[model samples]
Target: MVVQESGTPRELEHHLRPSTVKGIDFDQLLEPLAATAHGAANKRPITGVSLNPQIVQPGDVFLAISGAKRHGAEFLDTAIANGAVALITDEAGLNLLAEPASIPVAVVSDVRKIAARAASMVYGTAKNCPELLAVTGTNGKTTTTFMIRAITEALGLHAGLVGTIEMSARGQIIPSVLTTPEATQLHGVLARMNEQEISTVAMEVSSHSLSYGRVDGLQFAVSGYTNLTQDHLDLHGSMEDYFQTKAQLFTSGHSQRAVVMVDDSYGQRLAQNASIPTESLSLDAHTNADWHVVNIAPSVLGHQFTIVHRDGREIHARTGLPGLFNVANAALATVMVLASGVALEQLQEALKQADPLSVSVPGRMQVIGESPVAVVDFAHNSDAIAKALESMRVTGQGRRIIVFGATGDRDKTKRPDMGAVAARHADIVIVTDDDPHGEDPEPIREQVAAGAQAVIDAERAAVQLFNIAPRAKAVEFAVSLAGVQDAILVAGRGHEVSQDVAGIDVELDDRVELANALKLHGFVTIY
Candidate 1:
């Protein structure tokens, strides 16, 4: 599927608005924007809202904000030609408008925030939204949100999901371009979910979404924190700034309650300073957290563990996905739902009957073969890469092989660390290209290889390293070199089907490539 352009309204053509929202007075729908503007007399009813000028429809209120490269007001002609009835913009945007504007314009200090508030009002999500659950972190956000949705469904309630992989309302599944949708599209999804009688929603809230005001004007019923690490420093610039951006979600304005994992220092700090009522979770039994995971044992699929509360209560649960991190994900999902007001006993029974925690999350520790144990995951960062490789380790003489690469135009600082982690964990490491968006792929691969080479030299390890290209060849090489007992991991790109290379779109799916490579080697694949 073609990835939609950023900020484009998606999955809203036929399902977003109900008949009741056919028209709403501009002043009523966007009172916040009108209250601060100069010419606000246009009282035309707004039937829709849009941020992208290309998708503007008749009777829509176009939101024009100041962008990094160009102001949204620069596209006023396009928005008007496409049928925008009114406009909401900042002073900078207002200055760009002609003296006699074709449409009524409302100026706001922050157009993005106003757009979210206006969308909420227009879509009836400001007051009638479903039980909102959100998870935010550097890693595990996707899996935790997916687990929340699974648990919600296991309890026999309709659930909607908006995350990195896809957005779903009722049965309509739309491919996701952003980890969190733009506010206008987000409110539209919530409204559609409300219309579909979905009682709950699970969403992945990225740091970019929170920093860019994509999740503004929304309140989550229960928000969750997994862990924060060295990633996204490209945008945030520093770890402190990144943590502060994520910290915004734990405040009273964003969520009513929170379930925070106190494993990392960031989570510990967030739990200590969070404004809302927060519940602490930890895998360490010694820590006096509200919830704890104990009695963990390896299972055929993954691991089974008990989620024990400090108040002498516990629920048994299991996950089909491997890795101790997945066990943390399952425990976090359980507590997040529990914090949302579900009875412990009822949740336990639903978990037992449905096995919701075992639900497959696309591209996340996704296993494709049994012999040689081929797997694909989205472990791009150092911490995630370390954990992923550790989880794939077996007791005997099975060599662990990893095929991975760092993304270009991202936090370049993490590239070496990711390589070092792979070298430390795997017997053989294959460095390859992973979506070198707008950057030269060779340098990116070299930097990663340099890190791995440093580790091999310093430790005098017996690990073999190879730098490959185009990704498909890397997977093929890994499979060819693997024995029946050895494991192969294709990391960095998981469920993604396309690669962005130097502004060009290239078709690629790691799972498909790995499966084909295994089949060519006469190895049995799980699928």
Candidate 2:
């Protein structure tokens, strides 16, 4: 039974974004798993696939897989109630079900492996698209993916993008919840990309997505490894596990080839052990790599560097994104484009002429002002915050004022570390909220402030502490403190449009608020 509601074409697209397929035999679909389909609704024709119970429709199959915090078996009843034609789940979920289920069930030993395959069959295979480029790492995944899309577009090719900030195919873009989308949405986005005539796609593949089976069955044309760092320990438990999860992208069946940045020890290990053919990349010109950035110039406008190729040829490249880290990001993107089979001469020339603003990632080191310089960056972790502050410190001959906060319900250990980093690098540190999620904002701020207070006696001294509840007020407070030659750093929640207060994402854009503050302070007239 199809439920049709009258609406505009745009409304219809949002509702029916996931393409539906039918006429496939329900039991036959489970042949891939060798599981017997049993229930009152065994022979129903499947029309679509879904993971979330609320989104399941008539003739849709639900995959009840385990998660980091909870088991999907708990939601079996919800899924069945939401018109799930059948359930494709592990033995644990099967045990949760009674002997006679309201719907058919496909019991599998590994639900992750089949979930994406089933999604692909219902919508379409994303592999049929022209090219799929996946970039994975702790940082720079979003920036690099945007770069790939920009470079491809400059070369007169239509490109699609999927990453931390948003998902875009053609001209349409939507804010992203995960660095990599869920398996169902990932395949659906790929299908939409093909429909929109997007020739090339660059996506971010996060460790959580890889570990949680969110990107189970998708293959990439070429995967680029950005440097991994110490983060996400609450989920991965250890740095070794984090590195291994990232390495999955470079394995035999995942990517065709790899462009590994050997700037860090982990990258060195990944390049050496990559199952597929790999090319080593480096930001340090002296480091031996197939591609390296030498003769670098870092400015307020970003870095201008010459990329030395394997043949000793140099490509003069410049990105307006700023910082030395961005040079590495641009270089990695250059190699990824090369791995995609774009002609070397074309890529080199295009890179030399690449407009930084065209590929500018929204919140990663975005400068919103000129005089009394202010910057907004998504430097949530300790290392990232330190790097952002240091980058600004090196560039400006001024006092650095920092406004940032720790995300609630995340790695609690990094709280003090972030505080220590801010206290060490920033002249003035203002602690505020960054996505409190389900945790109390006050306690989260205290942990970060405690860390900062331990390292430096800023509370009683020059470093200012403001217990601002609302994020916009924090930005206003930081702006108020800005004097001549003083550069302010707004860390955490870069390019993010909402602040996760309590449980809901209240509309709060850093750039929007920062730009407003800059304008009020008479820093920039045109936002």
Candidate 3:
């Protein structure tokens, strides 16, 4: 007998305001948008928002946003031909002459920002369904968001995930390029989740997304802070600016609560200054933290720990994820899950029934070998590099070598910092290429080399440092240097299957290459 797949009923179309010939006062909203558009109009009218030309129905407003290498407004004619009732754009877009059309064009200043606000107004329905919880930090945002989704699902609620890895709404997974999607796409996803009865949204709010106004009008019920480290400086200009951008989600608009992990200085600062009530978490750190992790021990499998919430309430838990730092990340996730109204009993039961959470966090201290242990991680910053190295040093009984590189066109200031951390922590260090996009590989390597050299010159540190570019070669060399008892940690790229060079993505899996390099050296594993 044939079986049919189960599916939900289709939802109705989105709500759109009717268009009227009598122009309305575009005064309150578009004044800033109009000034940026260089268009003077107090009575300009707009009907609806439409980004896609092919799907644009009659009496809809067509928007043209500037893309990486092109402008979205270039497709204005296509949108019009497809039945756009009104045009929403800046002066450059309005100036594009087309045959006399019957539609009215509403010119706004700061088109991107205005479009975001407009889209949220048009499509945002977070209030009608489950509360939206926004998670923002330099690190742990992805893991925390996914963990919250797990806990929410354990409580039998439909939870949606939006982050760097992928998006999950009502059991459908879609790949994403940006950590936080464009306002139009984000609102559209949330609206679909709302329709599908997925009440809770756990989203990663990136610094770039916050500064660019991607989540302009999102009404987050609670916002969590994991911690801040040196990252994304190329976009934010300074660490202060980057922290301020991340803080926007916790303090801005309609965020009601701030769940912060105060182990980092920035997290503590955010909690102290938060407008809303804040819950703080720390792992053996001396702080007036509201939530804390204690009784920690590491096993070959993972770490076990107990989390103490406010009022001395404690839950014994063990995560399959590795390292002590991850325990802190788990604590942040746990606190947020509890704050989401999941009962303590449900949280404890879910922790027990769910698959061990360790070895599940991607590129996070993932071990691939035993004798000559090979680990892969996405630790690109100084603190993260330090944590990964420390974890390896303690976990590995013998020599520990680290292979890593600083990413090009991104926070170059951290190159030396990362090098210093690696050199000081590991027994051997290999500085290699990491996405030297559009930058000279030698200079990038030289910067990291200087950092390692600085650490070596200052003190005869544990790690012997070397530099090699064209990342694959460095990995090959690092593997060759390893012995039976030595571990080689390939850092910076973890579970990343591609290498980006001068703006081109090339297939390069560090883990696979590491294994191949081991095979070339006649090292075979018996599991």
The lDDT values for all models are: 0.88, 0.79, 0.72
Ranking by lDDT: 1, 2, 3
What is the RMSD, in Å, between candidate 2 and the native fold over all Cα?
4.2
lDDT, candidate 1, 1-527, per-residue tens: 32332333533443445435656887675565554545646667887789988877778889998888999999999999988888888888889977757778777788787778888878878888889999999999999999999999899999988999988866667777799988887887788788788899999999999988888888999999999999999999999999999999999989999999999989989999999999999998777688999999998859999998888899999998999999999999999999999998899999999999999989999999978888999998999999998888454688999999999888899888888888999999999999999899999999999999999999847999999987999999999999888988899999999999989889999999999999999999985
lDDT accuracy of residue 338 in candidate 2? 84
lDDT per residue for candidate 2 within 213-234, as digits (tens), equals: 7777777888999888778999
Q: Which consecutive 10 residues in model 1 have the weakest lDDT in total? A: 2-11
Model 3 per-residue lDDT tens digits across residues 270-333: 9888878788888854778988888888756468888887697887777766667777777777
- Poorest 10 consecutive residues by lDDT, candidate 3: 9-18
lDDT of 2 at 352: 62
Q: Clashing pairs in model 2?
A: 302-322
The order of the candidates by TM-score, greatest first, is 1, 2, 3
Error of 2 at 420 (Å): 1.4
User: Residue 289 CA error for candidate 2 (Å)?
Assistant: 1.6
TM-score of 1: 0.96
Best by TM-score: 1
